[model samples]
Target: MGTKESDGVDPRVLRTRRDVVDAATELFVTEGWSVVTHAEVARRAGYSKATVYAHWPTRLDLMRASIGKICDEADHPEPTGDLRADLVRGLVDFAEDLAGGHLDRVLGGLLERSGSDPVVDELRRRLYEAGTRSLEGVLRSHLPEVDVEPSLALLVGGVLTRGAFQGRPATEEFVADLVDRVLASTGRGEEG
Candidate 1:
């Protein structure tokens, strides 16, 4: 048989979920998110809206899952301890992700909903955490004693809102230079 859904969803649930998200991403890129509806996503994915919503309860759920899927597909390499080099690589990856445009749409839609929707707010926090973990780990390695937790929010949050709001592309060189400023501002000596 195929996947079944109950108290716990099945593995094929994941596949079906991917179909829905792929459909959503394509629609967001091609038609703009405000114009895309659950019915449109269902048609694109060749599934019922009930099937889509069974796996993704809300638009926020679908958006978060789409971003997570994109990140997974990117399969970005982990940083290898060189602060500047790692930051440049990570920022390029992020810029590529952002410039793909679906992510920007997803972020924008969710942000609007999140102003009054607690579920959207939590979904955004989870998405941000997922995207920032590798960068945060690398930053802490470079400045172990620095309160880098706040930096996690600042760096990624700033990049997303600023880039999206300003319609500015995030360049690797820009981020690399920003890394230098961060190191200097932190007054950190050699982390080795």
Candidate 2:
């Protein structure tokens, strides 16, 4: 059985929609979400304004689609049973992703605009919650019964504080050490 969203929509249509969404995301990340107008997206996507409007009736609709694409493009790490190794691996991958200029820009924009715009605020909240879910998955696999909220704060706070505030590169060694400390704090380390 073919679904309307999957098999019914033509490949060309999907490609064009992706192009437009990508263009909008780039604009939002680079120039701030306020700059993502239908005209600009159409121009960047090589589509007519009418075509953009046909796909997305409103600017907010386009913005929501772009945000969805951004979230969809993010890496979601899966736990591999070895807590320390998985944490280290996942954190290293996260550090690399955060090091990208596009992600950095998008995160910065989300933070800066979160307070003023309800949509951005919701997006920011959802993004952080998504990250927490991944971290909790790792912890749950190792801990018999654990409260993961504090651990979530620790892991996310450590990364952001180290990279964004301290202006330090999240080297693999640093990430590994951080994961070790977290495991130790939660009584999951070798000595525990």
- Top lDDT prediction, candidate number: 2
Give candidate 1 regions above 4 Å deviation. Answer: 1-15, 29-32, 53-61, 71-74, 166-168, 189-192
Clashing pairs in model 2, backbone N/Cα/C closer than 3 A:
none
User: Tens-digit lDDT track for model 2 on 66-178?
Assistant: 76776666666667678888877777766766665455666776787777879878888766665556666877777749877777677767777788778888888998888
Looking at model 1, residue 119 earns an lDDT score of 68
Model 1 lDDT vs. the true structure?
Answer: 0.68
Q: lDDT of each prediction vs. the true structure?
A: 0.68, 0.76
**Cα lDDT over the full model 2:** 0.76
Report how far residue 70 has shifted in candidate 2, in Å: 2.4
> For candidate 1, lDDT tens digit of each residue in 1-192?
122322376668667776888998777655665766778889989999888877777776666666556555544577877876776677667767777745666566666777687766876676666666788878888778878876656556556665677777777666665566666667742432
Candidate 1 clashing pairs, residues 3+ apart or interchain: none
